[model samples]
Target chain A: MSQESQPEKTQTANFEERLQNSADQIETTLRSLLTDAPRGTEQLRPPKLLAAMQHGVLNGGKRIRPFLIVEVARMLGYDQAGVLRAASALECVHCYSLIHDDLPAMDDDDLRRGKPTVHVAFDEATAILAGDSLLTLAFDILADEATHQKAEVRAALVLGLAQNAGIGGMAGGQSLDIEAEGRDRTEAEIRQMQAMKTGALLRYACEAGAILAEASAKEQAAVTRFGTIIGLAFQLADDLLDVTATSAQLGKTAGKDLQSHKATLVSLNGVDATRETLNSLILEAEETLAPFANKADVLIATARFIANRQH
Target chain B: MSQESQPEKTQTANFEERLQNSADQIETTLRSLLTDAPRGTEQLRPPKLLAAMQHGVLNGGKRIRPFLIVEVARMLGYDQAGVLRAASALECVHCYSLIHDDLPAMDDDDLRRGKPTVHVAFDEATAILAGDSLLTLAFDILADEATHQKAEVRAALVLGLAQNAGIGGMAGGQSLDIEAEGRDRTEAEIRQMQAMKTGALLRYACEAGAILAEASAKEQAAVTRFGTIIGLAFQLADDLLDVTATSAQLGKTAGKDLQSHKATLVSLNGVDATRETLNSLILEAEETLAPFANKADVLIATARFIANRQH
Candidate 1:
């Protein structure tokens, strides 16, 4: 290998190590939280529901959203059990979205993370309930004292989460995506939808860190900007992978964008332009964190990783 | 009119008038909340999503849940904007469940409250998204400072809402209901499912009232018990309606329980037994509220309403 390639390879390896560590911590937290089944006379949450929830969440994924939450919170000096719990809560919402999106009525996906989807492994009704439970659990975690000592902070987290994951955010974006199918959409329209569907939660992950730290509004805005750029880059990377990566690499179907007529940046701008856009977005994301200097090195690394991930 | 029935007629009329007033207030609050469009550059929640949410919520249901929240809180000398907001939040969850349950994969009903179900009015995807949005919006409402002056109260409300509406509560019960279809379930099992599916939210509604009032633990427990008995009576009445009422009167399909092979209480026991059970439950509910005496007359009326609604 060339000498220049060695540094890049080492950076990639370091980023991967950091990500893996975050994923491991997140997994442990989530497993404990989701599996704390009802004890004694508490029989509201049945065993079947718990099993379905585990099937959806415990299925191996990078847990990237929670990683973002954890890293940002740590950078803001907000490393409490509350922060970790909040991160896990965010992951639960992400997992829930995936489970629902893969439903037959939505994406009709049979596989996710290289395994049978929740609706496939469990039944459709069970899958739906699991997703609903996970979504509700996210708020439950945020609203609890375990998530934050400050009621205001917990309230803020809950509000931010609901806004991001609700109509104007993820679900609305999804609705738009379904409507956009088989129809030509302007680049601006596609971008709007993408921001809502994907960017909102990513943006929330960073904003949550700020809320956890009780950071100034300016700092919150800056981190939000950072999250937004990376969020777009993440989508671009995903679109690029759709054309270039195999289903085995993705752990889900590849080339689905073209087949479903889904509007994506790559479909609108072509692979070359999309790659160029991703590169610029990553640079912007890096610049957004320049105020934090070296403290944001890991975050910058995360941006690059998001922009360049193979899966 | 017989002389004996004159006073009972007056009482029923009084209850209807009070319920109508509560329903009006809830409808106004929901409309304003749902239609408050984003200001400036914020465009996450789309108009279509908002419209769908309103369709599901603004329909002409009695808003019985919110009414319960209001009456109970008032009985406890806790009448504030927070009470109303919390009530609206609860109603949102109830409406979301109805929309989702009516989906083709579930009950597959086309009509709700004499109008096309959400999926029929819009599309399957929109209905799903709308329900998802409503569920999230409920937490959003509870977490806002406007919902409660105290952060702990807000946090507690969020926690309570999540616990009641989540896996161990509404969703878990829903899962059981679907799984129980075409399967024989003992009376105990059916009652358990009903408590989780329907009772949890109603239970939450009353508990919310007590929590908002900062009522004592014993008072809260008693109100919760009152809510539980009424919730069970509500379900039994629904089962009775399924067997007795016409589709036109109900505004949705009747005889669905038997058609779906659902293990409802009325199905497990005979209609006469179910009616007798409902009467005893109503008596129990009224007794549970006896501590408040005449202050809880409206709540007692609510229990009677649950027992006697023809549709």
Candidate 2:
């Protein structure tokens, strides 16, 4: 109501608008990439495979990882078209992970983003095929000459993506998480698992932006550090939300960690302590961008947004 | 014995020796690539995940695919170390496909190469993750500088691999294969499905070798044509064996295509006619390598080996 509060409200509102706009862009690009791309001269893709892939990717999500990629690229002055495809590739990997993680053998969740999970919407076989296609398509998109003008850059992107998504990264982390279910683990062990399971891809998104911009090693390292801190914050906020947010608000099953006896930061430190840690991590993330100062306003805001998000 | 029979026996002996030698090299290279690679600090891969992946890949079948990659690369005069990693990458993709295709949702097979299938040996979830890790690891190997001296070549290899392995290629073909179960399909339709499924990767392996060698476009096309014909031959041979070989010989469930009512070249044309067609295809494959003359001997031998194998 007061003048001082007005600008802060507008800033938050602006970030929301930016996030929505980026998601829209990603949706359009992803649709065309998935459906229209020629598999060969015959165009022999199974209609059902395409349907399952679209079902998993097209409907809804925050697109936060892609937004980071685009924002960081924008901050470094890369063309929108050049980076959008790359960002979309990252989203494909993310969507694939979610699809697989939600399978009956894994999380066994039925709801995602307020709708049926891919396996529930389609059959499990179709869901598995769809996930595989999406992951493969991510690399195909990056390898396209359209993603970047430099071959080295494209190679770097592919390499970075494969690293984060493979064993010792997201997939490896998921394996650890699965093993840790209903078991006790130290906080350090939990951090490592979370870092691989979720944090790896997030870090890669920022690193990809840096690669796109051809930033200096020093500058890339800074953005990467920023990415890592926010990645931890993102996990902390997610754990906090698991206990605090409702199923309706989260668009996924709520209180899952507690129900499944999954180890998490909130379980280890309790909610109030976890919140304090998340706040400090957000500040730490913001400080990592100090060299960029005004140019990094959106990124700093992104760190806070990640921490404070209710869903 | 006649004097002329001496050279014929020697040729067969030489081909057998060459095949064994190539398989040995591939097995050694694949083991090193899978076990020693540092994905990130501390080599944090879960033991089960690693176990599943290695079980799917190692101590396995003939290693025919990797042999093709290495032989083709050698035929084009590339260094063994430079091309072997790339060859191994393709084999990883092949192994991943086998692992997933054997899942209960897909072919529901319990055996592969006389050992329990990955899903049977491990749990279903670990098998899925292992397949995923292997697929991701393939791209990682290709993107590494060790695969090729030229970054452009590496990018091209990654793009080509993704294209063949994704929806328009192996996955698409698989979708069709799954849909075709218990259904009749025209010969043309069967060919198309086979081409996309198994044929695509075989084609990619040869094309990859050409790409690595920086061969002329015309030369690449010739090798690619050779790959296509052999891919067809490979499928025909497989279909024939499904009917003729015992489960022990095939190292998988025998007569599965018949039991599942899956369409195949043999199913459509009958065994006698299918064998004739396979022979013709092998000849066609050999003719495509005419440009290389004596340099093509190993490839020609490989084509015959594929068509004539009992298992």
Candidate 3:
């Protein structure tokens, strides 16, 4: 038992290292992307708006979505500059959502990642513009020729990102979740909302890697399915953490779901069942990537990390 | 004088009819695009968010941006379904900006187009999501195959729209304007702000048309210049109307610039000089389209209408 535990510990440490490296790389890429220098047809980047955008995005999170994108593309034998740019673009969308979500009218959280949120750090108006700019910047990055040699690829990435982040995906999910607050939502309704809110972006992260790698239709389907399963796992783990962890552990307010009467899976199914479902989701994600075999080691580890993450 | 005035009245009537027709077409296109049906990987469209989006976008405006896109494309000898789609996409961006700008933390306006603003109509959270969803939907529409057959065209449209609407363009302009409020701003500063805030999207509206028509670089430049001039004229006219028109005439609170201590050309140069500048801008716009000859008649009329508009 001791010997078996040693290898597992080593594997976990290795995966954490990989995750840290990916996070560092994404941070650098985002820094360059958010620089003061205007690109293409942009007239000039407003200094205050730029600063607010940097604040909202440069906070050190796990960058799990970017890690998934990088590792999935690497597993598919596509490691290129475009992959990093695409990952950064997705991170921009995620960061923008956080900024808007933290506004006074939304979650109204003053702290994010253990620091003042965008609206608190800057004025609410600046926060809104920063979020707007980051979202626009995402599409700009995806559509740029530097992101991909093929225009079709760039267009495809833009379309996919927009679809995932738009009304029917993340935003739609946010609407559903907002409406579900202070009400007892059915389990299925909660799942649907979760799938759209957090799950949609995570799914896009994996699918975008396939699109960038020019993976075959079958391989794309497999990776997409893998993404969908892990997305569920990620949300379930989040809901569980919200219920079981403290604000200090989460780096933001926790247990607010109960305070706000927000309907979450854990609220509906209890923590133990949610945990069980999360484990099953990780297993399914692993099975979905089985066809990729040894090449998918990092992606498989990522799924486990998502399912078991404390924050 | 009477005979000359009769021809002038006939021309004005014809131009107004054309403008109304374009507005009607754009309205239909927007209605179809904003339907409840989900498209392209969207799991579902939340009803509340959809309603807020429709409310924000379907408000009766002149649809000036869409009209410019349609008219410019027509001038370039290209009119198709793609033109209308692209026009609608630009309108979405326009409407989204208005929604966000009117937020309580921003302009805090209750009335838009003689109706309650999105935030007032629904809720602040819904307004933010609706604005976000509309922005995202714009990129989605531009990237779709129906917007343009060639992926290159689609990609260009996406890139252009993102640049014009993102950090260095409309959003950036908003930041500048916000910062300049309650402060003394130079004429140049005001122009730069207005150019970014209002000019960028208007420029894109015309540039997109040239792109769709695959017009020569020279023609594209000319049309783009026309758009720039008219964009300035649009803002100047708006400022003029703000000072001169009553609230009922404008369909919104008039003299808002003065009330908010916002800087504008009308404030700096006085109404008479600002009117002179507006006329010069309209003349410059007409001259820019001179190379297009008879094909540019509608566009020239549109420019004149923009400069002379009361609301």
Candidate 4:
């Protein structure tokens, strides 16, 4: 564990070579999926709202949620288009969350993906509507478009995503997060807040794909387990990076959780110990996927990506 | 028109009389449903988040959204508990919206339904999470507990509500609303904003019942139309009241919109003319329900309640 060996640049290249194709496949579709993606040529007004929405969703980001969504779709043997559509819909919700989260009342971050946050880029009100429209458009995608799959499965997957993203889940977690500020919370309470705030939707991004595939109860359980672990590990890594990574490296504001003094894994456990815990958790997650070894590589790669990435 | 006798006291009494019972009904279940709402609660650990969730949702004001939801369900010939349960989820979302809407960044209203806004009642961060949690809990209800319906139907309904409530529908409308302050938006734009802000969710409530009934395409279309008209007309009437009524009369606050210079029909049209337009819309809505003349008095009465009410 001597500074974790930085992947030796060549090994990093090799790892990118191994996973870059799949990652690139996801990235390309993500870019196109939002390119002037109008709701339709219908008479739906609010042209500016739509424009702001496109700006918010299309502003370049890693597209992590969609990548996971479509990866599960791909692992289940669906073609690129099918997965991309679902992935795009998920991206809409993800973008919506970020926009709302960036609102002055919420997390209040003014930059996203290395650019001005929606409110700052546009105006606060437009940013709000952009987020709202994106959210509604997400369901519209499932209901109106995102075809080729059974309506029922699409419906269930969309619903699951909504469930995880909403009040009792991610948004609620965020609320608790705001509440936790400047207050000493028990570790269990802190974990619960993080679980809801970050973990819930992250978990759903993985589970939604399996749900779309109509994966079996056993497969569903496995993916959920995988989702839960990745979600927590993802948050912890995020916490660690907030402490260790610079704003330039992380591509967003860093040390925010500490600035806010909100309870977080890093705040709960010191950075070095959190690093050890995160590494061990990654190993544990690998074990969780051992049963589906061949199909689990991307999922495994994603976990490692979150755990070890500089950003 | 000479103020049309101002409906004196009877209008409110009648409107309140119509919605009061349902409000009472929703209130009765408020505690039990939220506390023990979701059936399979065993696996949820620590339960504080859900408890905080229950804290946010339970024991609230008049259940206008649920009233509409259940009214629509009953209008279609079923008073099933399942429908009410499904409707209840929307109430949670609506409550969350109100809570968030009252936040400092949004409307910044300190009072909601004659009570302190969630943020005022709770901490700002807690209020954010409370609203966020309530929003998420809505979808979770349908996904986790509404065990009576087909997964597809449930998913569609849940997705519909979540999407509408989030960015594109309610939240988007609010953004436009916040932006349009003092900007002199046209009548059409004001109506469109109102439709999205207020009408979208109401429309979903009506549509949700239809989806649950597995209503025929034509019937669904008809119900959707009914919902659209009602939703629009309701907002129109509400705008009219904001001008005509005072804060005490309205039970929370009034004239806030006018004070903010937010565009409204009354703002565009003179007071008397706005009242006429609102009436015409109401008449059109009540007439639309004639096709379902024999189904449920509750629906007709509900329509009349909105069309002909004061406060």
The candidate maximizing DockQ is 3
TM-scores for the candidates: 0.95, 0.97, 0.98, 0.84
- i-RMS for every candidate: 2.8, 2.0, 0.5, 4.5
lDDT of each: 0.86, 0.87, 0.92, 0.70
In terms of docking quality, model 2 is medium
Off by over 4 Å in 3: A1-5, B1-5
lDDT of 1 by residue, B18-111 (tens): 8888898999899877884852223566777778889999996898899988888899999998788899999999999998888887878899
- Give per-residue CA lDDT, model 1, range A101-138, as digits (tens): 99988889999988899989988778877888899999
RMSD to the true structure for each prediction, in A, is: 2.3, 1.7, 1.7, 5.0
Q: Is candidate 3 or candidate 4 better by lDDT?
A: 3
Candidate 4 structure quality by residue, lDDT tens digits, B41-82? 112322444555555666556676788777776777667677
Models sorted by DockQ, best on top: 3, 2, 1, 4
Q: Higher DockQ: candidate 3 or 4?
A: 3
As for candidate 3, its clashing pairs are: none
Clashes of each: 4, 0, 0, 14
Predictions in order: chain A TM-score = 0.96, 0.97, 0.97, 0.88
Query: What is the DockQ for all candidates, taken in turn?
Result: 0.59, 0.67, 0.90, 0.28
Q: What is the lDDT of residue B133 in candidate 4?
A: 52
- Residue B245 displacement in candidate 1 (angstroms): 2.3
Candidate scoring better on DockQ of 1 and 3: 3
Instruction: Please give, for residues B1-311, the per-residue lDDT of candidate 3 as tens digits.
Output: 35465999888888999888888888999999999999999999999999999999988689999998888888888988889999999999999999999999988999998999999999999999999999999999999999999999999999999999999999999999989888899988988898999999999999999899999989998988998888889899999999999999988999888998887889888999988888888778778887878888988888889888877
Q: Give fnat for candidates 1, 2 and onward, in order.
A: 0.70, 0.69, 0.88, 0.34
User: Model 4's lDDT to the true fold?
Assistant: 0.70
